[model samples]
Target: MNHRSDLETDGEPDFDNVNRSESECLVGWDDDNDPLKPSNWSNARKVKNIAPLVYCSFLTPLGSTMFAPAIEQVTKSFDSTNSLLSSFSVSVWILGYFVGPLFLAPLSEMHGRFPVYMVCNALFVVFNVATAVAPSLPALIVFRFLAGMFGGCPLVVGAGTLGDLIKPLNRGKVIALWSISVILGPIIGPIAGGYMGETVGWRWICWTLSIAAGFGAVVAFIFQEETYPLILLQRKAARLRKETGDSSLRAAAKPERNAAQIFARSIIRPLRLLFLSPIVSLLSLYQGVMYGYLYLLFTTFPTVFRNRYGFSAGSIGLVYIGLGVGSGISVPIVGFVMDHTAKSVIRKGRELNPEHRLIPLLPVCFCMPIGLFWYGWAAEAKTHWVVPILGTVFVGMGINTLIMCAMTYLIDAHPLYEASAAAAGAATRSLIGAVLPLAGTSMYEALGLGWGNSLLGFLALIMCPLPWFFYKYGGRIRTNPQFQLKL
Candidate 1:
């Protein structure tokens, strides 16, 4: 079929959603054209449906980094001087990000995405409240870890929700918008948390997050509808069986496995994709590197400015604006370019290869290294604070581009393993992000900012060709039997 027909039909309907001889009188959608199918939802309805997911996605990551400025105060509140323990309290939330998705992504597949969002969002609010009232660092760390797990659910399940709502071809813009939400949360977090930490106290940081999350939870519970197709079909089947008194009626698309099996695959398959698939492993590595560095820079950002620039806690948070501005500018640009690249190939009668998605990476990949060099050297030079801040813009643009380009490519490349591949990518990225900052202080101290950043810049420059290498030969790599994952 041509692209237009592909867009129009979205392939043959699942037998459960449209009764056919093959389905043997199984229950299904009202008809082949049922409007309840997420793909068939109206544009306005789609936006309304996704609003909560987008909002929660934005809010959860904010919880992770918004407390960056308050770490010292949070530590002092417990009367401890251990630097490792303090950073651990903050980074453990990211470790929750790693653990949450490994299980949550699969559970969403079993139960459906809507319920997970609701349960996770509400738990997130409750845990943050726990964090606020905790009497000691150990208590605080435990609460924050729980918060991180629930808070990070949207990052795993929300992508699948977006896929449910938007067709593959039109996903570029929505993904870009989603990326901005994910990226902006951390950027905006410190700015808000800084002021609260400086003036009110560190506890308000958690209180504010809980308050914002409570509002988000209520709105999402009201507005977000279930988008997973299998669950929708299952619901319809149950309704049909009840009405018609037909015990045999069941959704044809329903999974054969029990819940235990479903959970096992959720745990194991992501690992398989991460270790067994070259495309997954490599892209995940690149994405993980970007994510790790982001954590490294942001967590250490306060000490950098406080010692060098004599900036207040509140002012250090504002410095995040450079990265935020760069991300803001790149979101639309990356989205447009990604969709255009594939469509342009289609116009020329060429099929859309998954590699088409990586086209943007070739150019934008350089932004990371360049930005690192600029930010590092400028800070070390102490020419002007603004000079270092400007460097973060490139860093922001590069990271945004990776989220859109690399992440989108992963989805396109592994259609069957989308959730698993995504989970793996997210898992490694979060794990690295959580662990790498432990070394950031030492690396900066030993190397100094100029040499430290230049070292990173050179490393980035060396890896810059990764995009082109993949773009050139990604198809063969995808099809290679050795790299193919059975799970």
Candidate 2:
């Protein structure tokens, strides 16, 4: 049996023998500048790896809404006029998002990011093709849900990869850039889907999206590399043990967990955080509600534009452009301000905490409801099309800012468990978005566009103060033992 050398460095064990015990050697980055560490990779390498993931991110949500313009066409083909069912055609995919992250996030923890991402992307492509060729509406919905299940892999895994690649201080901007893919995908989907559905057929929307996803899968398979350090080190340690005949060589500090336990923990831990952790619960609720409101707009926009503004299906799609512009403009500004504020907090002799992320959200809280109120009243009164469009711009900025801040805060709070943290947030938001749109048409029909949206705006106003509460109390909440993952 080989033993460690007596190299007294910081009172830690130092292994000198080739066949030393696992406890005698630490398996991590060789040093601060180690090329193996994702954070230390060149900027070009980082972009090369991250850009595909970002594009995948955009494609997933784009798939979710690409069918928005085709909903009526689909309903007519299926001979179904039930509003709930019509909405479900769009929302069942999101329901799949709720289920996918529960398993995918944990699987990535056990395996690695690249394998899960590639497999999921391929699954997404296959299901999207099935959706395009489905013989019935039920078959189409099932295919769509399957597509979304696979599509959700990027949302969960991408954040973890970003956490691995970027330092905490500089994560905001990269996250912001990644978020652009997400924000733009849904907004742009309708623009294209509307034109296609009106011109060729609704089925072409699925065909086009599947083609795009196939391209994404190919690019990702060719370019993206494994990111999770633990997996890489584990593989390295296995090779070293095989070569050196050392049975004790291990990558992790703790005893190995069985597959069952790891799977259980992955599913349970996020749920615990969602329910028990105040920070997670508040952030999840806020982000989820905002997501639901966005989906609500997906339903309401068509109604308001068609009935009030007398726009064609293709012309109605143009209204989403304001939201696209607003979100694009806000990404850089919010990212810059978030990074600057976090650094300033550190400069002032304060330990950097997730709370600093909320600084950018201070102005955003008021923007959501104000925009909603403006949009509601303007649409109710049948004002100029530009008025409601501008209101959506504010709503877009507000929600985008809130999402960026909440996500960054979650990532910062749980650096080791970023994937799980993101899974919780994604699942919550998806659940809300999936269910909320079902009521959108009825609400608008009963309350009219003005009062219906005003109700949502009021809810936004009520929720606006949540960030302030969390920013003040997050440190204390994080200190709870239950909230901390073993990782």
Give the root-mean-square deviation of each candidate in angstroms: 3.8, 4.6
- How do all models score by TM-score? 0.91, 0.87
Candidate topping lDDT: 1
Model 1 stretches with alpha carbons more than 4 Å out: 1-13, 16-24, 41-45, 167-172
350-469: candidate 2 lDDT, tens digit per residue = 889888888889878788999899988998888889998999899889888888889889978886666567778988999998899899999988998889999999999999888888
lDDT of 2: 0.81
lDDT of 2 at 402: 87
